[model samples]
Structures are given as C-alpha cells and as structure tokens.
Target: MTSSSRRVVVAINPAASFGLGSEVGPALVTTLRGLGHEVTSLTEPDFAQLLDATRAALREKPDALVVGGGDGMVNLGVTALEGTRIPLGIVPSGTGNDMARGLSIPIGDTEAAITALTAALHRPPRVIDAGRIAFDGGRARFACILAAGFDALVNERANRMRWPRGRSRYTIALLIELARLRPIEYRLTLDGVEHVERALLVAVANNLSFGGGMKVAPDASLDDGLFDVVLVRPLGRLAFLRIYPRVFAGTHVTDSRVVVHRAREVRIEAAGVVAYADGERIAPLPVDIHMQEGSLRVLA
Candidate 1:
C-alpha cells in the first residue's frame, strides 16, 4: 500500500438524526476505501454495542478513527481513543454536530464534509484540549461542553421519554424543564479557589457550542489548557426567555446576568443536577473536570 493511504476504522450510529443521515456511514466507508485506504466499518444495533465494536477496532491500531453521527458519536470516539495518538475523524450526521461546527467542519453538507475529512487525513491532524470528568462510577472524556444545570435537566428528561420522537422530543422536554426551572446553589472550586453561588445553568466548555449550535462560550479556546466556564445567574421566566434566544447567536454573554470563567480544573457541586458531556449524560453533580491540554488529535 502507498504511504499516503491509511488504515481507517469507521464507526457509525444508525439512529443519527433519527435516521435522516443513514446514508452517510456507507458513503464515508466507500469513499475512504475508494481512496485506497483499508476501512473497517462498524454499525451496531445500539450505542453501547457500537462503542464496544469501535473499542475493539481501535485495539487493532488503525491510522485514524472516524465517527459518523452527531456529538454523542463523538463522545463515543473520545472514550474509545482516549490516551491514544490516533486522530478522530467526524462526519456530522447527528442532531447536534456542535463539535464539527466548533472545528469549522462542514455541517449538513455530506459531500463537503467528506471532502474535508479526506483532505485532513492527508495532512497532520490538529491537536485540541479534551475535558475529562471524574465521577463516582467512572471517568468520561469529552470534546465539547459539559452541561450541569437547566440544560442538562432537559437532556435527562428527553432521554427518558420514549414517545414523540425526533427534535420535537427535546422541545417538549425543554418546556417541561422550563416549567420546573429554579436556581441551583453551587459550590464551585475552580483551580482550587472555592465559591458558592446561585445559578440557573453552569456550562463548562472545552469548545464553542452545544445543544445544536448554542454558542454558550464563544471565546472558548480549543488548544488552551482551560475551560470557558459559563454561568447564567438566576432569572425570572420572562427574563430567561429573552436571554435564551440570544445564546443561539452568542449574544447572551453581553448581558449582565451571564458570566464566563476560565479554569484548568473545576469541581462542580449542585444538588440533584446531572451533567451531560457531548450530549451523553456523565453523572450527577459533584463531578470533577480537568482540561487536558492538547489531549485530543482530530482530523478537522
């Protein structure tokens, strides 16, 4: 085989975007194999099985590991290739392709995204910081934001619901969570300095966006050994509605109620709050996060 060709393993999520982009996985594998790379394609019945398959594939030491799906698939890749030198490649086929968006990867345009991936494979992979969360049960790695407040509650509720599928489920869950919104009293320790505060949401971000392009931390740096920790202070329902829309455009940071903190290590403590990283639930509050500088190699 030519030196330019790579031995690649592609893991795909069939439920990506609720099957809207089911064609992406097959296309990616075919394209890579056509480009003279040896491709091992893995498509499992569920997320857990797919993760297992991907981990097993990684044991063979592929040149690159590519994931076809949204941010959750990216989370799977993060854990599978953790502490390895192998680069992670992404095909944005999932609901929240925030990780791809943060890296300037083409979104919703399958051909363009594939072209970008192929080109990146030839060049050196980009190195970025990765966040590791250590909880009681286990530790998980993430390439994007960690939600430990109102946003995470919505994600938790939505994941538990079985009916009314697609993005609408998230909408319904948001309404439910919004109705139950209240300020959380948090004891945060950032780089060993402790502070107690009340906030509606606390997002610790390694990259820019989460929850479908909501730029909660627009100034987040990928290579820096720091987290752009965002805190949305307590607000009434009407005020929250006004600020919520601004987050999509990242204008929320301009408001007096929103605050951003940079920290390399963060200990988040809020009673009864579950944290979500890269769209996957990590654990309840009291999770410790460490920003590992240049810990992730990505084909972007």
Candidate 2:
C-alpha cells in the first residue's frame, strides 16, 4: 500500500505499558489524521477482544494496520493478521517493547514514529519471518521470540507486578525469582541433532532481543529464514550472577555454559514446564517451533 492511497486503522491498548496506553491513544490518532490518512482508533477490550477487533479492522481492508501498544498487544494484532496481505505498523507503548526495539522503531516518540510510518507507507513492504508454537492440538502466535524455563518465570512475574514500569520492573522480577529458581531437565532437538541437559532457560529467536534490551540471541535475524536457539544451561547461583550482566551486552554467547545453535525447526520437551511466546503463555513443554518464511509484510 502506498502513502497517498493507504487507509489506516490504529488499535489502541488502553492498559498497556502499565497504563500509558491512555496517554498515547489521542497523540497517535491526531498525528495520523494530520498526515491526511483516513484513520480509525479502536480500543482493545482485553486479549480476547483484541482478536475480534483485529479481524473487524482487517475486514475494513485498510492499507495498513497500526498497533498502538506494547509487545503483547502487537502479538495479539499479529495473530489476527497472519496469513493476510495487510502489513502491520507498530507504535510501541508496552513495558518491554522488545519487537519494536529489534526493528529499530522509535518507541515512546509518537511524532517521530508517525513521520517514519508516513515514509514507510510509500516504500515497498519488507517481508519478515515469524515463528509459531504448537502443542497438544493447540497453537499460539508470536513474531519476535519464545522462551521456556527461567525466562518464562521472569515474564510471569513481571506480568503480575503492579508498579515499576518498563525495564526496572523486569529487573526486580528477575531478582525476586532468582532465590527459588531451579534448573529443569529437558531435551532439545534442533534440526536433526538431539541433546539432553539441565537448563536454566531455552530461548528461540526470530529477532535479536527480549526482556527490553537483553540480546538473548544476538546473532538472530528477522529475514534469515533460520531461528537462533539459545540454551542457558544449569549454573550455580554465583555463576548465574556473574553471567547475567553479559546478556545485556550480548557477550554471553561466547561462554561455554551457554550453547547457541541455528536451526530451521526445533522441539523442546520438559515436565511441568512453563512456556512463553512474545510475553503470553501458550502451552507447556513438548512444543514444536518453526519459522514461517516471508509470512509477514511489516512496516519497518
């Protein structure tokens, strides 16, 4: 869709990023309208409500769909728009705008993002890869990243916190969970190779980062047609403390305790495990993850 002819529908999550959604809604709509695009703003009622609103918005057959919230909101919109021709534009307003940061989108700066969106609308769409998680006849959607074990626990805790927005909340949650966390035994099959280990976390990436700025899979690429599987193997509490800082700098990949592999598909199995995609729980272990090539045409 081109700039002059495109129609836009902006979906707002009024409770995202610790309630910053209410503040960003008006600013984004005003900017898009000022740019002369036909704009409609829809408030997301809840996770379930988002899917229907997204389908309804897509039925309008707009040139582009704009998501005005954080990663979870983006995930909901993407799930609704997957396998369709419409491209997605994101205005990051979540606690951890991981996907937006990975795509180099300007988060929290509505004016700059709107200007960028205007420019992006005129350019050819960029085809990016997205990942899928499947288990027990059920599947959930995500585009950025998926993780299990310690990282998933951290996400669960962060979701429940009532204060301390953004990265600080995540940091506090991680620290709080550190005391009682235990490594779980698991088996990972990547491509065709099989391995078993006690692990702290297993992260599969379609993009580079998660938890705000931590480069859990630093070498991951959105269009590479491959996913980076990173496993943080069992480590003592002191060792975990020593290596945790390196994750933010993305230098932890070189450590022996951390194993990184590239594969087109992977399967993970563990007992009583927690799993998360983007930031939402999809299933337990024994899950299959694979990349969908050229599945999304995103406004970068």
Task: In angstroms, give how far residue 210 of model 1 lies from its true place.
Answer: 0.6
For candidate 1, give the lDDT of residue 290. Answer: 90
Candidate 1 per-residue lDDT over residues 113-231, each given as its tens digit = 99999999999999999999999989999989999999999988999999898789999999998998899999999999998999999999998899889999999988988999999
Top candidate by lDDT: 1
Estimate the TM-score of every prediction. 0.97, 0.91
Q: How many residue pairs clash in each candidate?
A: 0, 0
Query: Which ranges in model 1 have alpha carbons more than 4 Å from their true place?
Result: 16-18
lDDT of 2 by residue, 89-161 (tens): 8888776899898889897786777677778887887889898788997887788888988988887888889
lDDT of 2 at 157: 84
Please list the C-alpha lDDT of all candidates, in the order they appear: 0.92, 0.84
Using TM-score as the measure, the top candidate is 1
**Among all windows of ten consecutive residues in candidate 2, which has the lowest summed lDDT?**
14-23
Error of 2 at 187 (Å): 1.4
Query: Quick one: RMSD of model 2?
Result: 2.6
